[model samples]
Target chain A: MARLNVNPTRMELLNLKTRTKSAKRGHKLLKDKQDGLMKTFMEIVKEAKSLRKEVEEKLSKAFKNFMQASSMMTPEVLESALLYPSAKVELEVKTKNVMSVYIPYFNLKQEGDILNYGYLQTSGELDISLSAFQELFPSLIKLAEIEKQAERLAAELETTRRRVNALEHKLIPDLEDTLKFITMKLDEAERATKVGTMRVKAMIEAAEAAEAAEAAAAV
Target chain B: MKNNYSIAIVGNKETILGFKALGLKTFNANTTEETVKILFELKKQEIVVDEKTGETKPEYAIIFVTEDLAMGISKDDYKKLSQQALPAIVPVPGSKGATNYGIRRIGQIVEQAVGSDIFKE
Candidate 1:
């Protein structure tokens, strides 16, 4: 129902018609893009859900084991045992495009064992905890990957949805309305011109008849 | 260029210093401003490009922020950082003890992934 400030002319009408056509085309393309984004987004979310559950379960177990180990060991012994780490992890991170959004790819290269503590000083639970932690490292990274990917996709989905809605609800409708207004105006102008021509023809015929009657009277 | 992903821990001095012994980098930030600055700096690291393939990679792959310090930041700022794909901002426990923040984050991710809050607690 919003009216555009435009002079209703044939040229403007033609231009608006073309614009509406392109707008419809653009709307369709954007809708398709949104659908594609949502499909991929959902798939990533599903993967992330399972991955999160696994990581959380393992991490909690690891934390519990660590607490148990800490309880058994003396403070000094525990401090020294974990002071020097034996494991070295080099992470290789790259990004791949999912739709228009770039999501991270994490690859870890781990060197050395995680057990740096001596058996004589630390309890078996301590060892178990450390090993569990080492095992959780990659899964942690993978969880980061999946979660980050989901976030990026979610942000994109929000933006795309906004654009699609704008085109579908506001822009396209406005253009169509403007085109209709222009067409109506042009048709009214054409009809007015036709009526004016007929009126001028009648006036000329009436003048000719009057002149002929006056000539007959003079005769 | 080191071909290894750099890791960083951000939190208060006492909590983050422990991570240094493990060969990971640590950033001590007490205020939300400081934490936000550190996060931005880490994300803005120059991308390394491979000579042959022309592929670029991030300098920092994972950044762990203590839950308490992370909570000090505004919600919008935290959400923005989380949405970024590079340098994933992970919340961890500080020295005081574990808050459920880390677990809750994972749970939220689960909900986002699964389209519902399936986790009971």
Candidate 2:
């Protein structure tokens, strides 16, 4: 890190001292925040991983049934069957702050029967597939909510980590260098003034003693 | 922070019908442009203003797009979709089969956040 390009004055040194003090404080606080964020992030990631696995497994099973059902019926009949669903599902989103990250919570609300279509047009496999998806819907929303939370928390943790590193390594060191330079400069200046005054006083004293001796000789 | 947010899915006829049966809203996109358009529309729906923060946000809580269509979205649009805090864009496999993109995306997010591949082992 480069020393701050500030004039070597006592005022500059005082300013630098304050800056370093604040930087240290900020670093400590950010380190704590980073630790908190990381702990929460790790927990969220673990939960999301397990949920994703379960969701993926269930989804595949439902998809397989869908594929089988699609094969058993004509394209026109299948399209007509699922084109207009009579039921509706909605989501309610709420967030709780964890380490300043707004982690989303999804509450799923379903209205009416999903199997509103007549049984004559659709096959038995289709029924199984739809019901499987019905069971899987809530879990799917929950997975999305948790995964998004993990992403947000991780991102925040990374930013905090960077800030902490900057303060601890770069900014604090630079401030110290500037403060040192100013202090040494002030000390050197003070010593030079003291020595100059002492030398002048010694020369004046010697001149006065010579004049007094000359006057005595003349008398 | 809002109520009555919608959950929707976008994919082809074969993939979307299954979710359609589950009563979630479904949008069928046959082409890349169409898929991008539908996503744009979904992103623009139901704007809500937060009373405390006075910030406007979309009301789409979750939008599940098939991996096939999501991969086809142009680079810029993909960025737009991912950047939104609301309406988490999740990718699922279509009728063709599981491509593992869904799982890989979560890993990617983790790696990006950590700045290293923590799951390398």
Candidate 3:
């Protein structure tokens, strides 16, 4: 029965060596990418954790303030005050690319009842709070964007890690082993050829010496 | 091909427990003989052979083995398992071990970023 055999050329071995080196380098880089991505991800996770807590606190505060405001003012009066015709708010949302990912940006314009309400028409505190909420909206959007980015990076990191491991542990090692096997076989062949050549040269020299001795003896 | 598959880890008790937390099935192999036995059992469980066609049917995607246990298996055994294409033998970092592998990988990525080389387009 014929068994499978591998015959690798010198050039092929060299190519494999280069490939192995490249694979090793690639493996290292992918690992780094994974780590960097993880670092960024962890940072984002931390930020998100803290931001979520802060947002929850702020929202609670805002709700409490709304309750206080509602309790202090009669519902009908407050409704009538808030019923004033205000400016309409128009929002423009756009996307910007960062590190090969798209993130959103928003621009807002206020027109109708939003601009004409009693709070908008008189007291600046509610208007300030409204603007604060508007600012918070962008931050929340940004948080969501970062969270999405972190998730994508985590997945990419995992994939990269797997590829790097495959190359490092399996493919490159296999190539190197094959290359070594071929190189050793080639070296053995060369050694055998060298020994054969040396023997042939010695035999030729011995034959020439014998012929010279025979000639001397004949003379 | 069915994408759903599971990973099982074989190692020390603590390591196995840690892996179990990660939702992986685990078996403990404290001794070298037990490790070999576990590996053999894992290999047996990993693939089912078709009696009629004499073909092997593979199961599982990967199996993580501790480095110590990994040394007990023969190269031929490793080769046989590799040929199956399922249950890729991955030597994961042990519980007490430093994340040198992860750190090295990260370093490589950083190097690639700085050099902008190593990857072919």
DockQ of each model against the real complex? Answer: 0.32, 0.65, 0.01
Quote the positional error of residue A92 for candidate 3 in Å: 5.4
lDDT (Cα, tens digit) per residue for candidate 3, span A1-219: 221145666877777788778888888877776666656655654564455445445533543444444455565645454443343323333445433334333343333333335454344544444444444433433443443343344445556667877877787778777777878878998999999999999999999999999999999
Question: Second chain TM-score per prediction?
Answer: 0.83, 0.82, 0.62
The per-residue C-alpha lDDT of model 1 at residue A99 equals 74
Query: How does candidate 1 fare on TM-score?
Result: 0.81
Weakest ten-residue segment in model 1 chain A by summed lDDT:
A52-61
Task: Tell me the tens digit of each residue's lDDT in model 2 across A9-102.
Answer: 8888888898899999999988998888888877878788788878888888889988998889998888788878877888877889887778
Per-model clash counts, in order, read 0, 0, 16
Q: Write the per-residue lDDT of candidate 1 for residues B1-121, one digit (tens) a residue.
A: 5456877779886555344434456788988799999998887775657768767766677888877887777878877666656678876666555666765665565454445556544
Quote the B-chain TM-score, candidate 2: 0.82
RMSD of 3: 19.5
Give the C-alpha miss distance for residue B49 in model 2, angstroms.
Answer: 6.2
Span of ten consecutive residues with least summed lDDT in model 2 chain B: B112-121
Among all windows of ten consecutive residues in candidate 3 chain A, which has the lowest summed lDDT? A84-93
The candidates, ranked best first by lDDT, are 2, 1, 3
Off by more than 4 A, model 2: A212-219, B31-33, B48-57, B72-76
Q: Compared with the true structure, what per-residue lDDT tens digits does model 3 show for residues B70-94?
A: 6567756655654433444554444
